[model samples]
Target chain A: MKKILNSADTFVRDTMEGIEAAYGDRVGLLDGDFRVLVSRYPAPEGKVGIVTAGGSGHLPLFLGYVGQGMLDGCAVGEVFASPAAEKMADMIRACDRGAGVLCLYGNYNGDVFNFRMACEDVEFDDIETRQLLGRDDVASSPKDRADKRRGVAGLVYAFKIAGAAAERMMTLDEVTAVTARALDNIRTMGVALSPCIVPKVGQPTFTIEEGQIEIGMGIHGEAGIEVRPMMTADEIARLILETIEADMPLNAGDEVSVMINGLGGTPLEEQLIVYRSVHARLAERGVAVVMPHVGEFATSMEMAGLSVSVFKLDAELKELLRAPAATPFYTNANK
Target chain B: MKKILNSADTFVRDTMEGIEAAYGDRVGLLDGDFRVLVSRYPAPEGKVGIVTAGGSGHLPLFLGYVGQGMLDGCAVGEVFASPAAEKMADMIRACDRGAGVLCLYGNYNGDVFNFRMACEDVEFDDIETRQLLGRDDVASSPKDRADKRRGVAGLVYAFKIAGAAAERMMTLDEVTAVTARALDNIRTMGVALSPCIVPKVGQPTFTIEEGQIEIGMGIHGEAGIEVRPMMTADEIARLILETIEADMPLNAGDEVSVMINGLGGTPLEEQLIVYRSVHARLAERGVAVVMPHVGEFATSMEMAGLSVSVFKLDAELKELLRAPAATPFYTNANK
Candidate 1:
């Protein structure tokens, strides 16, 4: 991988420092560790503070969403590694506006364990807190245990809903309920054509033959369900949609929002090609697509592949999706 | 040079069809000639309909910025190739409201020539039109004629100012003046570690030896003024800043907005590292950064490099920069 850098170990911390310097006036870090970047002002009195924690590398994903109309604070983990429970607890305390705090993140094993423990510890401090886990990657689990799927790009949508609800001074339980609802309707599936390089390892996380693609690959380079010869755009789109439909069981008439995300190296043009095929097949299946976003919404550092995320939007989900929330990454037309 | 596709010629047109299919209900396209895309519903009646055009390949750069709070319409040329003058004239007429139309684009030679002809044709059609060029690439011209530099990512800023002013019901001339002012304040420089394959050619745009980079390279794979061995993030940041400073001459205590945009293949993590170095250098130089947008604002297919853009902000430019605008590519808090 060609890049401009000093060392892999310093990637996350240095990036966070730059983020602070650029937006520090609007945000602040925890007393010691800067990983727990938060708004300069804590949540208002009696408001539910929202804290999201996950491994770094996904920009505008966690920290980008931490701002006025979005997250109150976020705990940064190491690159694709979960932050410690103690640090997570501190972030919750710093942003807990009197009402309570909600800790939200993608459903990864290490993340799940650490954040849950942090919630309990924060509660022991007499600070009310709850955990909202996003399990939206249909490719990670079969139909019977779809809830066991990994969380992928759909976490962004959950952040939006939860962040907006919290910004409106919603109660902790309400924020959790809204975010859970958002996750319930969100389903994502990803394929990797190339592997991303871990800074420490200084090598690829996964590998494939020149023209091969692995569908249902995890972000941390976890093994995918199957490997197949590279397929046409139409074939790949069909494979992703078929898996998502079987896992989530979306009906023929369901209306959904589509996200055609690039895994870094795949150009936007290629993503749009996949989007065209996906849209055609969805139309053939009599599904209605609303508010589709075709771009690099979430990426895997220089990996060449694409993911398709479908969010089955109801009145509430659609309204939340349309609501204006400002994050460095995501934006909406309605405020 | 790896891509999954049948051919390159059909790429952009097919992608446009898909973009329309996703958002086409609200978007309209010119029937066959220019491939110009415009907004649907209540086309502006008495306002200056802003028309911007350029080659394809820069996903959100020239076209993605078109929508309600942004451009009225866009005419897309072939991939990395400028559109014909007659085609631009046709699109300008389709988008022209009774007030007049404004032609906005980069300052590349081909773009300048075609856009000038389009402007003349529109004037002959008894419709008033003005041309505003974005010449922000500092490395393209000598210090004395930085105004002749090719437009890079700074075009986004010009588009923002023009779109906001037009939305506020400004006259065509007023919009032109503000856009020119914003463009004048903007300066950009880029580096290239590798090159992207032109779809038809199926080869890299340029070749670089291992462990080497081209500083001040153009977005379309044009050669840089300085060719140096690959350096650390600090060294690269310094090279880019020095080039921009030498060209635009930003002084200490100047307030500017920074955009660290990845060319294509560079990861967001690496981009942030570059940002870290850039922030430190700017702070050391006593410059106050107003807004720092760090991501892929403009890209060259799958090249591994980034560009730094600094737009010196006045009160009006800052207000416009902060104003709410929503397009496929960008969105602010209020949108």
Candidate 2:
């Protein structure tokens, strides 16, 4: 393996230690569990607490979003592995501010099982928490089975709207409602040119032959809908948009927020290329892009791929999306 | 040759088109020169124009900084090549708003030569401008010959400070003076686990044997002072700090801003690991870390390595460093 790491055995702990050291002023470890990272800026009393938890390989996903206008805490698991239920419960306890907590995460089986258990554990403590699953990957399921789809880069939108709602002191139910609405409007699909290596594995989670690409691969190297010879950026953008539009059915005059996310090894220059095609396709259909984000938002370890996410916006959702946010990996001008 | 690109000849233009398409609201191309990207938000009538430019491949460097509280314009070049003098002059013209422009970039020979020519060209139009060369790579030169050092991640510091100075309506000379101060206080060093592939070349610029690393390597695969067996993150961090301290002589109670920049392919998890060591080393020396940034700031086209930059700060520099800034790849809370 050509990775620059100390050892597979200590990878997770070392990384967490590093995270805490680097962001000491903004974040802190849970009192008893280091895996549960909490924001140092305490949430306002009576404000809903926002928490997300999942595997660790995707930086700025679960932990990187914990800040003033985003997540309150996150339970980090091993790379591509779900965190334990106990750890998730600890994260909930750390962030609960008496107004109740909202648990949000991707719809992976292991993540669902563990977060559900954590919700139950938190309920036992009378924390009064709610849950919302992100199933935004249109290629993972048919339109009728949207709830079965996996979450991809669209999770960042959920974090933004829901966190803004919570920051505005919305009730837990209101926060959950806004979060679900964000998820409903979001649709994401990805194309992978190469695979990512989990540190512990010391090898690629999966492989792709040279000059070939996999459409709709999950972040953890999950099976995609199809594999084909590599195509131009324009062609790939069309394929991803068509798949998402078929499921969500965007229309003329529709206003939407777009994200072109790089899956680790892909450079920002190429991500912009993909975004160019996406913008052109959307404009051709008379769909107006209100807010556009182009960069590595969610990623596999070092996978060379890109994902496109479209979040159809309403007045309420647009306001929440434009709200100010500050995090290590993401920040927006309130204007 | 495992790249997701269309053609080498059209790569730079295609990427620039994509950038304009994605960020049309905040940025736009110069009227007569597509290679020059200028901010859509107009600068104040007498505000100094902050401009940066260099070769392509380093996304979020030249073009990404062209937004509020940052760069006013950027001239772009082909992959790993200096932009033409004519293009640089066009960028200067687009950003000049009565107040003079400040031209800042790394101390590269080609860039130096071309930018000098561009300066002469812009002078014909009676635009007052100043130049500040960044030379922060300590490994590139001895302490007595610091001007010979190559600029790496430290260039980002120069951008942040000078951009803030310009935004605060500092005079052209004032912005240039602060930028030069920032460059003097900064030092950087990097290690490369592997080389980057130039898209046009379709091959790695250089190679490293498995289980080995090159310390103090340049961003463009330039030769380093030494190659050695890969070591643990702690050992590597110690070596880097020792070398930087030997050259710059960091002292106790010194306030510094630290940036752990991923060259390209290094994941955020690993970058955090490196940051952890950097924080600990500074703390051990009783040096105060004022602002810490860890991520892919200035990249080298998906190169599998990272660079460490430390900028010692004074009261005046600290205020500018903490000033509000919004860019595609970076944002500050402005607290």
lDDT of each: 0.80, 0.86
The candidates' DockQ values read 0.54, 0.62
In candidate 2, position A24 carries an lDDT of 69
Taking the tens digit of each residue's C-alpha lDDT, what string does model 1 give over A60-122? 567777876678888878778888888888888888878898888888888889888888888
| lDDT, candidate 2, A1-335, per-residue tens | 76766788877777888877877678878874668888887677898999998998888677888887888999988898899999999888878889899998899999899998998998888999898988999888888877788988899999999989998999999999989988989999999988888887787767899889998898989989999998988899999999888888999999999998888898888888888888999999999998798888888978889899999999999999999888766776622
Docking class of 1: medium
User: Taking chain A of candidate 2, what TM-score results?
Assistant: 0.97
TM-score of chain B of each: 0.94, 0.97
Who wins the lDDT comparison?
2
Residue runs of model 2 more than 4 Å from their true location after superposition: none
The best candidate by TM-score is 2
How many clashing residue pairs are found in candidate 1? 1
